[model samples]
Structures are given as structure tokens and as C-alpha cells.
Target: MSWANILKQYEQEFKEAEVNSYTELPDGKYTVKVETARLKESKNQGIPMLAWEFVVVDGEYEGRHEWKYSLIMPERMQWLKQDLFSAGLELEELHRLEEELPSLLDRLLEIKIETKMSKNGKEYRNVYIQKVVDRTPSQKPENPFSPNNPFADDGKPINISDDDLPF
Candidate 1:
């Protein structure tokens, strides 16, 4: 209630805050969930743009966020359309697409992100949506009894010779 108490509480909150750095993750294909998709005016150019925020759903970078922006310019329209398509929308018109942009939120998309150093010498990651797919786990099933199993050949069991056996 007092100002001193408020300051102490704020300090405690800051002490408990988790620190996450902006280190660029390795360039790779990742399955991401669309956390946000919205149209906004660019700060410098005052041009309308579509901004997307995605969170990596799998891999070591899971929970890390990546962003993609598409300026609403004539030359960039095709790219915007492709981005929307990759987010699971197939509308052909920009106006219609804009109206449907909110639907992209929470969609699962496969994206290829590349890492590069910026002019300021800071590493950054760029998100490029490759396609939309079901939110399935990235792991493949293992078949221990199959011929292609690493421990045995097809139609054969792992052989344990007496000489090679570990006693």
C-alpha cells in the first residue's frame, strides 16, 4: 500500500523475471504455431503490413518466437499470398485475405528459418513459412523387428556368437 512497499514488490518481481536472450537459433526447418497475425502500419514508412509471430513447437528451440513481416505493396502481394497460403488460407484476393487473416492465429505451419548477421553485427533469424501441416510430432516410429533395423537384417535376428558374447 505504501510507496516503499510498492518499490520492494517491484524489485522482487524483477528479481524473479526469467531472462531470455535473442540468440539466433540454427537455420533449419521447424514446425511452428502461429501466435499472432495482424495488419499494422509500419513505423517508418507508414505502409500497411502483415506481421506474423510464430513460436517453435518442436526441437531445441521450442517456445522461442520468430517473426515474419510482409509489406502490403504491389510488388510484395505475391509473397503475401504465398505466406497466407502457407498459413492454410487459399483466398486469391488481398481484401478477402485481409479479412481472413485472423484465422491464421493458432494454425500449424512448417517454416524454414535462416540465420544471418545484421549490419549491426547482431545475429537474427528470419521466418519463411514453407507450408501448413497437421501439428504432428516430428519423430518417426521405430520398427525393432524390421529388416531395416540397425541391429538386424531383414528376416534375421541379431546373432550372438559365443566368441563375441559379453560374459
Candidate 2:
């Protein structure tokens, strides 16, 4: 294929792409899937850190990306452990966690995003891993009020008169 033909393939995407891809997403909770996670040096002082990339799984902002960086140090171990465990990863050693980082990719997770202003008056977004979201098919009914639900609160079927509803 010629250079002109290769560029034409991405013509639609180029038109739709944002002017800058670094813009931060708004603060809110989101369901996302881990797209990338790896150990890398911090930009400021070259300290070791784990960097992550997550893409919103579904919602108005679907496909929007966010990042979370966890500094690898003794003091940060508690929070780091919480985040890792929330993503369904538990390890006895940090090295083992690093080795198993790949397992986090493609896992569904609930994340909370907050925007904060720094002392320098610059705003930044903080992403927290709230919990792992199970997307697998389960035996439980998706709707609690659906008829004949085996896991209903009572053995009897739920029946309600129109007058019972507040409307």
C-alpha cells in the first residue's frame, strides 16, 4: 500500500480524535476495565511506581481513559494493597504482585475519580479502585421484582395492587 492509502485508512479517526488526548475526565464513579498496568519510574524524582490505564466500560463516557499511579514504597503499602485487592489480586510479596500485574488487565472494576487542586493551584484527577465488578453470568435473577425469582425474599410470589404504588 502507498503512504497516501495508509493515511486514508485513518481519515475518519483523525477527524474524530481529540485535539489533545491528555485531558482529564470529570470526577465521578465509573465502571472500567484495566487496559494496561506496569511498573515504571515516576516522572518527578524517578521513584518506582506502578502505572495503570483504565478505559470506561460503559456509560456516557464509555471509551474515555483514565490513569492511576501508585508509588511503590513502605509507607504506601496499605493503600497499594487495598487497590490491588479491590482488583481481585492478593499476594504476600510486592514482587509477586508485580509479576502478576498482567492478571489485572481486562478485569472489570468500579473506580471513583476525584479532581483536586494542588498547592501550586494546578488541578489533577485522582482515580481510586473501588472494587472488582463481576460481569460473569450468575444464577441469581437480574431483577429482584421479576416474577418467579428463585431468590425472592419470601417463598410467596410478589403481588401488588395499583393503589399500593404511590404514583
Candidate 3:
């Protein structure tokens, strides 16, 4: 098909209504689920760190995400240990961190998130997982990204096949 003809056919489809982007949640204590947790290197300090992405599961900012990073090296182990303890993991040894941290994904916890201004006077937010909450006997945790999950509505997981692409 000619480029002009293709463009003409899809012109109306491309003019669909605009969707609003997610805004930062207000600074407060909220219940959140661990959306993603992984070990990553710090770009500035060149140290290994545990990076976590948490999603609010309730209230007005239900689907918003917040990030938290805990440095895992010897010099920063104290803070790292505290964060782990707050997340319901009590570890006295550094070696066990790597083996157990990944299991925290999808776990729900109450967290205190605060917004603060940096040295440059720009505002940003930080999340601190305060405590891990236990699920009721009849309830089970669900993945927000799963097809059947209730929170997956606005942020639906798209599955695009290779053949569906134009190029």
C-alpha cells in the first residue's frame, strides 16, 4: 500500500482521545504492595543496592507507584538492615540479603512516604516501608499486573505480537 493511502485510512484512529498521565501521590502513610524488587548498582556511588517499586493499593492514589533504594554495602549496611527489618525480614548477616530480598515482591506493607526538597530546591519523594501487614486467613495477595486483578484496569498489561507491528 502507498504511504499516503495508509495514512489516510488510519487518520481517524490516530486521533483518539488523550489519556491522563499518573501524578505523584501526596506525602502520607499508605498501604502498598511490592510491585518489583531487584538488586541494582548505584550510578553515583558505584555500590550494589536494593531497588524497590511499590504501588499504592488503596485510597485516592490507588495505582500510583513509588520507588525506594537501600544501599547494601558494608558502609551502608545499617540503613539497609533497618529497611529489611521494617519489611519483615530480620537478617543479622549480609550474606543472607541477596538470597532473600527477591522474595519480598508482591508482599503488602504499610509505608510512610515523604516529599522533600533537594539541595537544588527541586522536590522529590522517598518511601519507607514501615511494617509488613498480615493477610487475613481467607484472603490472598494478588498481582496487580495479572489479567484478572482488579487494579490492572487503567494500567492494563499489553501483549503485542511481532506480526502486529507496522515495521
Candidate 4:
């Protein structure tokens, strides 16, 4: 189909679809689940770093995501160790992070997030994992971000067939 025809067909959806934009969360404690984790090289220095994307599991901001990055350096190990331990992944060797990173996914924890503005007028967030929360496998949601989810972005209920019900 031509671009014009395609746009015409989806014009209503384009207007109604919500834009997924980035907005800093307010400074407060939040219960989040680790959605993704990886070890990557830092942009500038090429230093190894553990990067994480955490999804808010509940509350007013449920389904919202925030990123946390920890550089693997001697000076930064203290804080990294503390955060990892809080997430229930205690490690004696830092090199073991790669093997353990995948385990962080689906782990639930209480995180304290704070937004700070630098002198240059840029804003950044600090994510601190306060503690790991107990979550049985039965309580886990399949995929909160999936389009077929029965809950809308605002947490309102969406129409679904009886087959969609877990029970």
C-alpha cells in the first residue's frame, strides 16, 4: 500500500496511541522487578559496567521502567556490592557478575529513587536497591509491557475474553 493509504488507515490509531516518552520518577521508594541486566562497556572509558533496567511492579507508577548502571571499578565496588547484596546476589568475586547477571532478572526488590540536578543543569536519577522482597513464582506477571495485557497503561481494566483469565 502507498504511504498515504497506510497513514489514512492508521490515522485514528496514530492520534489515540500514547507516546512512550521518558520522564523522571519522583524521589521515593518503589518496589521494582529487574526486567533486564547486562554487562557492557562504558561509553567513554570502555570500563566494564553492569547495566540494569528495572520495572515498577506496583503502585501509581506500575509498569514504568528505570535504568541503573554500576561501573566495575575498585572505588565503585563498595556501592555495587551493597546494591547486589540487597538484591540477594552476594558475590565474593566481581568477575562472577556475568554468570550471575541473568539471575537478577525477575528478582523483586524495594528501590529508593532520587532525582538530582547537576551544576550543568542536567538531571539524573539514583536508584538504590533497599532490599529483596519475597515473591513466589505464582505472583509474577507474565509481561506487563505486552500489548495483550488486560490492564491499560493507566492501570485501568481492559476488555478480554474468558480464555485470557489465568484461572
User: How does model 1 fare in lDDT?
Assistant: 0.81
Taking all chains together, the TM-score of candidate 1 against the true structure is 0.63
lDDT of 2 by residue, 1-167 (tens): 89999899999999998885576778889999888999999988998988999999899999998889999888998988888888888888787876798778788899999988999999877789998896342244456566556766675566778998899
What TM-score, computed on C-alpha atoms, does each candidate reach? 0.63, 0.64, 0.67, 0.67
Q: In candidate 3, how many Å is residue 2 off?
A: 7.6
Instruction: State the C-alpha lDDT per candidate.
Output: 0.81, 0.84, 0.81, 0.84
lDDT of 4 by residue, 51-125 (tens): 889899899999999889988898998988998899888899887888988777888889999888999999877
lDDT of 3 by residue, 1-167 (tens): 98999789888877995778767777899998888778889998878899989888889888888888988778887778888888887877767777887668778889998989999999877777789875222247776457777666566675668998899
Kindly report which residue stretches of model 3 are placed more than 4 angstroms away from their true locations once superposed. 1-8, 43-46, 135-167
Please state the error at residue 136 of candidate 1 in Å. 11
Of 1 and 3, the candidate ahead on TM-score is 3
Residue 24 lDDT, candidate 1, scale 0-100: 65
Model 3 clash pairs are none
**By TM-score, is 1 or 2 better?**
2
Question: Model 2 lDDT vs. the true structure?
Answer: 0.84
Task: Give the Å error, residue 131, model 2.
Answer: 0.3
Cα error, residue 112 of model 3, in Å, equals: 1.2
Instruction: Compute the lDDT of residue 96 as modeled in candidate 2.
Output: 81
